[model samples]
Target: MQAPGGAILEGFIDLLVEDGDGLRVVDYKTDQVALKEVDERFAGYRLQGAAYALLAAGVTGRPVTRVDFVFTDSGEVRSLAGAELAVQVAEIRTRLERAPGEEPSGGGDDQLRLPGLNGS
Candidate 1:
């Protein structure tokens, strides 16, 4: 999928459901956690959810108004919609457009050093 900013996105969505309202993207998570901590534990997955939503919308020609994270371990589902969903998508696009030479923030001694890259 080509993002509005011209970035090419490629991935497979676990599932996409079409209904009366619009497209819904579902990503299954197997993380073991209690229901009460579902939101906190899955917070980092919002970007992935948004990406799936964008991909589904592009493929189906329908607006993706909802993104769901289904946690199989605890049978909990978390959703992002409306303004929050838009924000997450926008953030993901921005990250994708960053200059290639720019290092991500919080760089430290623990930075990963791949073999034969950056003189490693």
Candidate 2:
């Protein structure tokens, strides 16, 4: 997938479900956390969910009405929708568009790193 700024965003989503409401992006998490604290523990995953939602929407040509993080360890699901999901996606996009020579944080094996940025 490609972001609006022409940056390549590639990933494999765990699941993508389509229904009358539109597309739903689902990402599986194996993190072990208490059910009551799942939301707080996995809050950082919102960006990942948002990215999947955007990619799924782009490929399917449908609106992504929901993004879900299914916690396998606790059998809990955290969902983001409406304006919250939109804001997350927008924030992620803004972080992705780095100026020349600017280094992006969270550069790791799992995260997508843009080439030619910060000497990468």
Candidate 3:
């Protein structure tokens, strides 16, 4: 599903592996990078992965315990699971919810509060 601001909030997954008492969400990455780069962009990609995990969890109801970001550029894949992704999703959701309304924020009738500003 896409959010009001054109952000996609769901996606598909490749595999759901079960490890006896635990589960794992398998993903693929084709990027070439180190863990440092991944750490830097955690917030950038967390939403996308969390969206996928949420959708998957809704369908499975087993709690998506893992999220894998397989970068297709450097063969480096990162994972953010459990509470980490949850926090990211929460942050994103909060930001989205608190975002400005459809109306713009600057330059409006109220902005002309100063006297003699309209060539009067």
Candidate 4:
């Protein structure tokens, strides 16, 4: 997908399921955080989910209503939808537009990096 700054971003989503509402993106994680720690762990995964949501929506031309982050090690499920998802997507787009070091923090994307995602 094309970011706000005209950088192309691409990645594979773990899973996609369509229901009455719309498409849902599910990403499996091994963070090993317990259910009680979900809130903390969930924050770090939001932008990744948002990116998946945007890509899925663009590719299928369907609204992405939800994103699910499943913590395999802890058997926990965290979800992002509605307003929260929108906020994260917007935040990620803002980061995508900025040049590498310009991102305030969590700017290291060693997990999955797109060549021009930092608007190179």
Q: How many residue pairs clash in each candidate?
A: 0, 0, 13, 0
lDDT (CA) per prediction: 0.67, 0.73, 0.53, 0.74
Q: Give candidates' CA RMSD values in order.
A: 6.4, 3.0, 12.7, 2.8
- What lDDT score is found at residue 47 in candidate 3? 59
Which has the higher TM-score value, candidate number 1 or candidate number 4?
4
Could you tell me which 10 consecutive residues in candidate 2 have the lowest summed lDDT? 106-115
Report the C-alpha lDDT of model 2 over 40-102, residue by residue, as the tens digit.
Answer: 766777777777777788888899999888889989988989999999888767766765455
Off by over 4 Å in 3: 1-9, 19-22, 31-36, 72-75, 92-120
Local error of candidate 4 at residue 28 (angstroms): 0.6
| Candidate 3 per-residue C-alpha lDDT over 1-120 given as tens digits, one digit per residue, 9 for 90 to 100 | 433344333445666777444456656544455666766665456655655565566566677777776666665667877678788656545533443432222221221121222221
How far does residue 109 in candidate 3 sit from its true spot (Å)?
38
Question: What order do candidates take by lDDT, descending?
Answer: 4, 2, 1, 3
Q: Quick one: best TM-score, which candidate?
A: 4
Estimated TM-score for each candidate: 0.74, 0.80, 0.53, 0.80
Q: Report how far residue 50 has shifted in candidate 1, in Å.
A: 1.0
lDDT for 59 in candidate 4 is 85
- Name every residue pair that clashes in candidate 4: none
Show model 4 residue runs off by greater than 4 Å: 99-111, 118-120
